[model samples]
Target: MRAVIATEPGGPEVLTVTEIADPEIGPGEVLLDVAAAGLNRADLLQRQGFYPPPPGASDVIGMECSGTVAAVGPDVTGWSVGDQACALLAGGGYAERVAVPAGQLMPVPDGVDLVTAAAIPEVAATVWSNVFMVAGLQPQETLLVHGGAGGIGSFAIQLAHQLGSRVVTTAGSADKLAACTALGADVAINYRDQDFVEVVAEQTDGGVDVILDNMGAKYLDRNIDALRTQGRLVIIGMQGGTKAELDINKLLRKRGAVIATNLRGRPVEEKSAICASVVQHVWPLVAEGLVQPIVGRSFPLAEAGAAHAYMESGDHSGKILLTV
Candidate 1:
């Protein structure tokens, strides 16, 4: 097997592809010959030595992939050799082969190709679990999304729109905002020159009902200010920095709740449940073409360093993929 390894975490230049031992499956696991893998911001963090894989996880730098089942491990059922599947991996999707728990394997949606399917699991699960399941965004509610041109934000905009919620999103430029609007955002604000909090408040007649945030502490105070009474704010990224003061008084006055979550470190049982929910709810939307993979660009597996560079440059929208 060949996988990407960070040769002393620092920059994209630190990443290199090298021969590695093949993975073996355990009970209830499946062995996959990876077709493609998705690139995410977390991958950049891992390369910089800010994030490390969970104990016993593959040190390889990918979190989701599409592949064909090569073999199923002991006690696995309902999947067979040659089945087309996409998996939410703890790590190791950057390799040619990976061992995934059967519970994390989802059949490729009817309308999607195998390579594109690699872009779905991580963003879909993150959006569905955070906005729908955890935040409890309801139809007719207004949802605010930060970084709307990126993978999770693009998916969140579409899914919220399709589910009957009014969507408001902020991006860095007019072109990015336009792209967000094309994906069904009801209101797109250019964060570089606009006040998203005010825009969301005016558009929603006070504030938004749910906010999917990636900027973390940099936007915390303003995020709380943008929320309506009883609103939910789910923070999934920390690109902005980790430490910030919270106004407990303001949160209490609005009766709002804050949640911080990460998909990578969760237990297998919890991940399995989230995967099942996505297969049930999100897969149908995708199969019907109501939602689709938003692949911004792809790189051959060997050029993963370039892929990381592109993503870090913030010059691309949606998911970047590595073709295995």
Candidate 2:
């Protein structure tokens, strides 16, 4: 199999294409002939040696992929050869083939191409788990999504809108904000020029019922202040700093729930459950054209280094993908 290997950690240049042996399948696993791989922010960190694959996982860096089932492993059932699916991997997605636990495989929805479907798993799971499951965004309430033009935020806006919630999003530029608006955000504010807190307060009557934050510590204080009474805040990334002082008084006064989570390190069964839930609850939305996976761009699998650089450039709105 041809794969992108990160033998040494450094810059994007460290990612190089090479021919490698195919992965061995284990019990309950399925072998996939890779079609497209989703490029994520964590891929950049992994390539730079800041984030290593989980212990005993493949050293390769990629989290999600879409493809055709080539073979089934011992004890795996219900899935047949030639199934069209995508899987979330602990490692090894930047390759021509991957062995994924059958439970981790999700069928691509009707009307979505295999390449565009590659963009679905990770960000969809992340946004649904963070904004809906964790934060419990309710209808008739206000939900704030940060980095609204990005993959997760774009999905967040659409999902919130579908649930009858008013979606507010913050981005860095006018074009990005427009993307969010097109995704069904009720209010889109440019973080580069406006204070999102002020914008939220003005637009939502007071504050939002939920906040999906990526800035972490940098937005913590303001996030608390921007929440409505009994609101919820879910943080999935720390694009800014990691540590920030919290105001317990504000939290208590608002009866807010602040939670932080990451999906990658979760146990297999848990991830499997989330994947199942997605295949059930969200795939229909995709098929119905209510929620579309936004694919920003694609690069050859061998050019993964360049792909990571492009993602880090923050010049694109939506998911960056790699064609295998």
Candidate with top lDDT is 1
lDDT for model 1: 0.95
TM-score of each model, in listed order = 0.99, 0.98
lDDT of 1 by residue, 42-156 (tens): 9999889999999999999899999999999999999999999999999999999999989999999998999999999999999999999999999999999999999999999
For the record, the alpha-carbon RMSD of candidate 1 to the native fold, in angstroms, is 0.6
Clashing pairs in 1: none
lDDT of 1 at 81: 99
Off by over 4 Å in 1: none
Candidate 2 local lDDT, 1-324, one digit each (tens): 899998798888888999989999989899999999998878887888888887767777889999999999999888999989989888889999998888889999999999888999998888777777777777899899899999888888998898799998988888898889888998999888899889887887779998998889999999998999999999888888899999998899998899999888888898898888888878889899999999989999988888988998999899999998
